[model samples]
Target: MLVTIVSLWAQKLFRLDEPQPFGGAELQLTLLAKALVKRFGVEVQFITRGQGPFEIFEVDGIRVYKLAYRDFPPARTILGSWDLLRLLLSLKTDIYVQRGGGIETGIVGMASRMKNKPFLFMTSHSWDVDGTHEKNRGWIYGTLYMTGLRRAAGIVTQIQNQHDLLWHNYGRESLVLPSAHEIPAPIPIKKEGVMWVSRCETWKCPHVFLRLAEALPDLRFTMVCPQANSRELFLEISQKAAALNNVTFLPGIPFEETEPLFATHRLFINTSEKEGYPNTFVQAFKWGTPVVSLHVDPDAILSTRELGVCANGDETALRNAVKQMYCDEGWWKKYSENARSYANATHNVQVIVEKFYSLLQSLKK
Candidate 1:
């Protein structure tokens, strides 16, 4: 089987040289591509823009062809639909996959439909809470996505939460493919303290975690962010952490380096103001680390998932939850086990790939 991906924005936004460059969705893509090539021995090629033309990379015995898209300035194909269809015909791909309709998917889905190609889109972005852009750009981009989803051959997402939310709001139904990663077996278990995987931005609400650090001085805090913003915003956060000695502000790490670092922390924290769903919950759990999160959504990660506790409402409630994680070792062990089990069940690679592969088979007829 052959899969051709239509994604330009994912390549651009995620390829930044900052912390948390690729969230859970991007990581899910990399893992899926690698596995499809190596384990399943399928032909996989990705369509992208800006990184120059088509080039091939071999990693872990898997082949990846990056077809760099270059098109007109007015913009025909800037949104991705026509140009991607052109690529699909030229490549003779059996299936055309779109990773959300942000900007690129809009292009890809349109192209796929025009050509009568099997179009499958994976909705990884959390549309409800972890929404992007302001009004003007958001509407432009959102319009593109809504249109794309409506015309897609089929749709997929990591968890039922995001999928259900999409169905509730837009009435779009997509297959639930639990996002998975190739978690590395640790060389050494370094249980230092607690850590957070998020960008230091307005929506993420990193300050809430800093407040927790303030209320609990003894515990160490290791926070990572790749989407760095302006100097003013950086300084404001720095000022908040100036007096605190236990907080370690680490820059974003690449996708290749995330797992080992995740293994070292005893617990992972999510203080996001909103989230579509998160990759950190899976990564932290893959390494047997428990998670503690502010009430974002019950779908992403939760107490029942065995990942950790979820607190809703105010900042004080979040703080109290963190203190309990440290004090209750027995409870922590139970949660740690739950995290691993949940991660394994939801994110099993073979299971979801078969789900995707089957959809393509059905679409062909």
Candidate 2:
């Protein structure tokens, strides 16, 4: 049986150009698509935003078709629906999958219904399942996203909270699928410092991390903050980090190159106001680096499983957690071992991909 999966990922995320944007949702899409191809022999394709009217290429055995979503400015309005509809119908695939909450969600959902194909919508943020994401994006975009949400044949969320909220808000049932990852072989690391990796967005609170570094001047810290929303904000945060003698700041690092940092770090810190199971958390766990987070804790696994510490929005607690984890060798090793074991048992890419394949196959029936 041959199965084809088409994804509607953003071009900036899928492309390999210089200064390419790095996003957790996009990276998961890429990893899932590649695994589907390599492991299950699934034919994968992507329809993404592009500068040209049409551009075709391939990445890791998956085919990509670019559409000029940006060229048609009116497409931002309902008037541009037919152009996107046309592009999706042209794919002729078995099913469509997309992540995140945006106007594109509605576009993909509408196209799938028109062609009588199953469309799976995956939520990437807590806001994605809750009503806030829709309300923040405004009327037209939000309306389109709701349309896609309603029309989806299936929906997947990163955590149980999202699943419960999706049902409560929209009366939609979804599977709680943990984010997937390919585990690397265990390596010995010196594990000397704390590390933070995230796009420099206001909501992520990169500035809060700088404050943490300043407060704990005795400890070494590494901040890998790439430019997300504002270039000026990135520079501002970079300068603040540079002034801290204990902090080493890098504006960006490729997604493929981040594992070494995770492997070498004793602690991984997350300062985001909220999130849908951060990929960095999983990466840190895979590399046996304990996490100490300020706000977000997915599934409450950090506390229950002893994988890491969730500060529950306390800046002081967050700092203390980091300092304690970095200094107490025996405590750190216990959490590190638990983290690695938990990651392998729950997030192994091969097992998750098999689950997706089974779900996709059932949808076909």
The TM-score of candidate 1 is 0.83
Worst 10 residues of 2 by lDDT: 1-10
Q: Give the TM-scores of the predictions, in the order they appear.
A: 0.83, 0.93
Using TM-score as the measure, the top candidate is: 2
* TM-score, structure 2 vs. true: 0.93
1-365: candidate 1 lDDT, tens digit per residue:
87776555345333443222345555666667767776677777765544565555545443445555444534634534555556666676677776744766566667667667777778766653134422345666766666666677777866777777668766777777777665444424447677887766777877887888877889998777655555566667766766689988765666556666678788788888666557777788777788777866556457555577777756777777777876788887787778777766766677666776677778763
Off by over 4 Å in 1: 9-20, 49-90, 128-139, 183-190, 228-243
Give the clashing pairs for model 1. Answer: 18-226, 19-226, 19-252, 80-107, 81-107, 126-276
Candidate with maximal lDDT = 2
Task: Kindly state the number of residue pairs that clash in model 2.
Answer: 0
